[model samples]
Target: MGDLLTFKAGKVRYDETTKRATPLAGKGLVTVAHHEEDATFVSLVWERRGPGAVDSHDGSEETEREELLLFPGDAQWVHCKKCTTGRVFALKFKSSGDRLLFWLQEDNGQAEPGTLSAADNEISAVLNSLLNVLEENDGNDIVMEDKTGENTAALEDTLSTTNTGISIPILSITDALPISSFVAHIRSLPEQALKPYYDLMPETFEHTRENLIKVIQTPQFFSSVDTLSSVFRDSAGIGSLVASQLGYPYQGEGIEGFLNGARESGLRESENDRVAKDQEDVMEE
Candidate 1:
């Protein structure tokens, strides 16, 4: 619904399919948002301040002189290339004119927008490269967990199992092994534990079972799982969680270290607790 990634960048263009690029006159606010109706559609919107414009995008803002460029998130490459003048991102696509380019920078409290420090700029460059890996993907990454489709097919296969087969498919949400056994198993499970979905159903089972199946069957679910895992794996502070789980020495030291740990873990009480509680009688109102 909102911007997934955004930055200020000037639009660049190629001349007659040549490598040489011509940077547009002015830079603008570039916003990246997902397609509202489709999970797979990622797109970009660039709004540059200029002469009067025809319309706006995604329902926000009625304004004059707004130059806008939109690119549907289908691109062959979204990599940053260093040029003699400065860094320009080459957002290559099968079609032309979708290259969303930007001048990467940090904004000082009083300085102009996009005036980032060198360190921040370096980090931004690295992140754009990472985005390239995620957004540049063209493969069909959605795959159902098991080799089965449709719950009915699974149940039928289970019911038709024969004596020639040593074992039934044991039909998981993902399997099938028997006619009588499967029926008995269904009767046995007032609530199936790990059959269709491997989640430990909550007290809200009636509310969530169908929702869970719908989520699992979604076309982008599998690929999204992989992409999110990769992002979290490389995210800062995740290492701290992994270290804590594995019983390693605390990565941080002293008061600063103790306070900066993963907040998701139960809060630790110590001599250096940031805010100590008082007796009920003396507590502040």
Candidate 2:
């Protein structure tokens, strides 16, 4: 939908192993279809589950019919509708729209501008507050935009009560997601579970493994390790509590070894060198 390009609905040839899809132009009308809000309208990867128009890439005029996997394209959002009032579409769905709820509920995944993902569910408190306000004004029909008028002498009824039609890029074939590789990748795997993929797709396996190690070696990961190390090497703050939770059997305070022989190798390094030096000087004095 970027830069106003016309997209003809098309068929695609998909490669399962490599996860690549090559689209063929279908020369059909494309619509945004209005993604529903009350339910997960789409899946991360899906098929329409019926015979669909497929484009025949051959030079001759021809086509095929079959199902194919669908993925969202580069653009994050679009606005279009199936019904036509001289090709009219609503920008924002009505508060009382019939299809606000969706029939299908799938785990919609895409952390983009328009796609609904896990992030939406994270704001329960805000939703609860909105629900309370809506409950208080149950009978009040507050339109987001009001165009009703009894006196239409100055302006015609069409002009007075017309809903302002907004402009948005129409969803088209070019906006579909590319399938050359996996749409998402895993940062971690089950213990030794990647061995099979290691033998099969060595490049992919190594790529994933290397990235996972890289993430672990990051500064954030080191900070987490520092927090974990304190549970055994120090008993300040909640360190002793965490150690006790880990079955360290510590009493009162301190992270000294209990019944378990588990302990950090060599001497416990001083976290605050200045404080340690002060303590040493005081002991000598």
C-alpha lDDT of residue 143 in model 2: 18
- What TM value does model 2 have? 0.17
Give the distance in Å from residue 213's predicted Cα in candidate 2 to where it truly belongs: 1.0
- Which runs of model 1 end up more than 4 angstroms from their true locations? 17-19, 50-80, 94-102, 105-285
Model 1 alpha-carbon miss at residue 271, Å: 90
What tens-digit string does per-residue lDDT give for candidate 2 at 162-279? 3368653322211121111112233345547555444533232143543343233233433454454455455455545655566543443333332122233112333356679999
lDDT of 1 at 1: 70
Give all candidates' CA lDDT scores: 0.38, 0.28
* Predicted structure with the largest lDDT when compared to the true one: 1
lDDT tens digits by residue: candidate 1, 1-285: 776766655444333222233444443555666645443455455666554322222233332222222233324333332232333344433222123334432243525332345654554554444334344322121111111111101111111224585754211211222222333344455455535453533333333433343233233443453454454434667545655775544645322232234332335543235355444435755
Worst 10 residues of 1 by lDDT: 149-158
lDDT of 2: 0.28
